[model samples]
Target: MSTKMIFINLPVEDLNRSKAFYEAVGWKVNADFTDENAACIVVDDNICLMLLTKTFFTTFSQRPIADTVAATAAAYALALASADEVDVLTDAAVAAGATEEHCPDKRAQEAEVGMHGRTFIDPDGHQWEPFYMAYQAA
Candidate 1:
């Protein structure tokens, strides 16, 4: 198969804010696929994140919109180049209004699994974890 492209669709309360948040993390907006109802974010060469207004998102599914305040619909994890890079992504997310109180605890988790990561909740309550791991051959 040709190089598979990954598209992750997300529901957002405020498209403008979400757009700004992702942009703060260094991802470019894909103008060709962006409009009033949705903003397409280019995460990488083949990865795209489609941020849709909650109302617009409803048209695609029959299930009720997830109550991000009371519960989580999903957790997205991004792999970075190193432990420091993971911090850079997470720090940017926090600076852009994401919640990331899981600090030293997150650091402690790294010691147990040989991985480093941090979890942050976006303004709309979407959870994201930026991580790094070195997998050595056995």
Candidate 2:
């Protein structure tokens, strides 16, 4: 089967707050699909996030929605074009009220090739790793 991209549903205790946080980081909402129960955050042409209220979110799953602030059940990572961009984005995250979980660090083996990364926690404590991997000559 051919693969196509879609949305990721994140259960949030406060839909408005989560929506605001993402908006501060430059995500746009798809009003056509948004309501009091959920907000469709557009990440890219094919990527999006369905930010659902906790009550509405539970309806779609048998398992309980994880408390992202209390425990890390999962993490989302994105790569940057350069190590400097990792630092730049991390700074922006902090300015947006995200907690800096770790300082930027270089991977020893990767250091020679200039790869580096850092981690941060969003308003709801979701972990995100923004990293940069340098190109290597084949």
How large is the C-alpha RMSD of every model relative to the true structure? 2.1, 3.0
- Candidate 2 residue-wise lDDT, 4-44, digit = tens: 87788888878888888788777789899999999999976
Regions more than 4 Å wrong, model 2: 1-3, 103-113
For all predicted structures, in order, the TM-scores are 0.90, 0.82
Model 1 scores a C-alpha lDDT of 0.88
lDDT of 2: 0.80
Q: What is the TM-score of candidate 2? A: 0.82
TM-score of 1: 0.90
Global lDDT of each model? 0.88, 0.80
- lDDT of candidate 1 over 5-121, digit per residue (tens): 999889999999999999998899999999999999999888899999999999989998888867878888888888899888888988988889577976786767778888899
